[model samples]
Target: MMSWSHHLIITPILLPMATAALLLLIDERNRTTKALISLVSILLLAMNAVVLFRIESGPNDFENVYLLGNWAAPFGIVLVIDGLSALMLLLASLLAVASHVFALARWHAVGAHYHSLFQLLLVGVNGAFLTGDLFNLFVFFEVMLAASYGLLLHGTGTLRVKAGMHYIAVNLVAALFFLIGVSLIYGTAGTLNMADLALRMPQMEPDRLMLMEAGAGVLGVAFLIKVGMWPLCFWLPGAYSAASAPVAGMFAILSKVGIYVILRLTMLLFGSGPSAGFGADVLLFGGIATLVFGTIGVLASQALGRLAGYSVLVSSGTLLMVLGINDGIVSSGALLYLVSSTLTIGAFFMLIELVERGQDAGANVLAVTMEAYGDGEEHDMAEGEGVTMPGTMAILGVCFAACGILLSGLPPLSGFIAKFAMLSAMMGTGSIGTTPGAAVWTLIVLVIFSGIAALIAMTRAGIRTFWGSLEGTVPRVLVVEVVPVMFLLSLTLLLTIEAGPVMRYMDATIRTLANPAAYIDAVRNAVVIEGWGPGTGAKAGGSL
Candidate 1:
């Protein structure tokens, strides 16, 4: 008999796995039944996530740690639920529900196993968020990538197939790096459990310590690839643009999965250990470069789909830069920004499909004409040719404006609030040494400039689609599709309304993360099975 606390921690993973398996048994033609099941599973997962969050946030000294089969930590599988994991679980659930609902309008039928793959993807993502050990994290990472490969090619166009193949090849290489890194860490640290590794890191010999750092560096590279960090992110825009709308919406959370792992490991393994500040410089500078790259991509993008893809890069880069700063205060604000930006980008991806539907053919022709000749007047002729639908343009216009505000960190929305919080936190850090450092100045300048670029790109795109191109045929958007976009945007509004409580929660989470003792203690003290002891089970180089 398991307690509610134990059940809640695993529900996000188990429920999805079970649901996906069940969906696989159902016929593809039973679309109604499949949709209902997926919706129910997502709703239940969201409810469970809320419960887990409340329990973690409550006044309790004991951590919400669960050991599978009653096995103790550092010896067997463990799942730990802290404020950060709870927040991520909640965010993943919300995005999952919205994407699923939006897919029911059309995308679900575009592929054979969309519903099953969607649930499996959630299983992977939620598992990654909750797992407390390194090996399991790798397992979940593979699960996620496997499902994402299918989702990326769901619609099955030539462009999608090519992009999907590229995406798969890149991730396969990353996965190889992940395995090598994990193997090296296990060999060096003598344990696969994160908490146990943290405990042992301070006591290791200098040679082994160097080996551990090398392993961690390799691991960091693997995660950076997933996060779309610079030089390794060439596949992102093309892959994202090729994906169907709902699938692309879900992909927004996928990059954050990498960011989450970096934050978790940075705090757990290195925050106060001998390796403290190990990768901070690389993350800091690399993040700034990634931000600059993303902003340039955003400014130069001609298509809304590509712009949404670049926007994901910008969000990832922003969080990475902040995490690189390595201040608890700034991290608290970055966490808020994480939630706001993920939602906004997900909504933006969904909205892009509807906004671009009316001018797809014209845009393609213009691209070809421009490429064939130096310049062309095709775009002028294509503009204002769309047919006007009474309420369609108005609804899309409002949603597009909301996405713009959120992306650009404009006033009154959650994006502005999040960026303001981060800026204030950074300023509170005061000048680095005697004068302000170049990184600090760069961060400030980029934040402002990125917003301006996003504003210009979104505004230009919006005018072309809504105001400038009224002569084109009106996009036929289903109510189901439109509602999900509204729901996502409305949640951003709710975040704005509930800014006080949310920020306080994020602040508390950061404090907990900064002090790693609590996390280590919880894992070390987790309940043990009857037969297992510290030295009795799988140790380093032994079968796990």
Candidate 2:
């Protein structure tokens, strides 16, 4: 029998896969049934993710792997569960449930098979996290990209379709980069399994190592695109801003997928290798540039959606810089920041639609136009258009303010704690001395300035949307539509409440990442068959 631990580890991927299949078989006309089924699957996936996290939380001595087709590591497909993967799985599932549930309020009906695509997207994301090798990672990456293409265009607007086309084209190029990179690495290293690659990273011939590093650099670009790094990130804001609110919320975690891969590979491939610190400078400087660019975008944003979109870039740039720092302390704080920012951005994405529902379709344009020119004639025409903010609008306003606080790294929230942890670690520890490098100081200044930019942008936008405008009205919001936003925000609040334990867990996870041997050994020694069956020699997909 497969171990119970293995079962839970595989549940995230397999459950969603199975759910998507079943959802596909269901007719689109039975929308309620499909919605309920998809929702239930996501809930179960969430529970399984939570359980896996709890399992990894205890002592984390070994990463658990389930080998498929009864083959051992480096030869067969395997699903591995560790602290980072578990945390990411939990985050993805939480975001999925929120986005999916919120979609049922109306967005689901806009597109056929929205439920199925949502589950398929989870299959890809969960698989990407769980897969033990580069081959499966590519497979899952494509799966995710394929599903996202559909979801990005879910509501079918001119904006969405146009954005989706560009999104697909860019990702296809990235996917091509991914394939070439993987092929190069496999050709040089003789294996596609990450652990096995790590085991050979330091001992490879000089020529092979060069090839591998080249491959790794190519691979990094593919993910850099996903993570919205500068130059490559130009398409991100427009695409994300054009996406429907629910889809945009779910897409928040998508950027983190790239961050996860980069972090994983950075440690496994270069932590203690001949190639140690190979791309550190690029990541550092690129991250700094990205942060600065994102801050400019944030401050210049006229629409709330674009502001939220730029915030994703800020989150990506920060984490990328953290990875470049390569310090366990900084990384731990980056993990916390990752969670807080993702939740905040997701909540903000959903809240934007709700908040904007009360305003005229061109209210953003009107506000910008008035600021740039004048509202001399337009304002008088709508003098009595404003209404008192009611309970629903008030709730949305509070959520919006919370999002701004979190995005700006304000006090009394997880965002503040996360930024404090990272900044302190960077300022206090400069590799070997008390004085940090110019790059470190640059990152610090950019982070602070970025926060201030977010604050200024959010305040200006909030004023236009709430106080400054005289044409706003109370939007009709459903309990379901509003609840998910609160749930996501509340989790950020909960992160604030449980900062100590969470940071401890992040530190432990960082420690696990610091040791690549644990992962290599776990994959190498994990049992394919728990015990030999006495029958016809058939069991478990031999499954993972």
Best by lDDT: 2
Residue range 28-114, candidate 1, lDDT tens digits: 999989999999999999999888888767776434677776667788798888899999999999999899999998889877989
What would the TM-scores of all predictions be? 0.92, 0.94
Best by TM-score: 2
In the range 40-148, model 2's lDDT, one tens digit per residue, is: 9999999998988897888643338777677776777878888899999999999998999999899999979898888889989999998989989999999999999
Q: What lDDT, from 0 to 1, does candidate 1 have?
A: 0.87
The predictions' CA RMSDs to the true structure, in order, are: 4.6, 3.2
The per-model lDDT (C-alpha) reads 0.87, 0.88
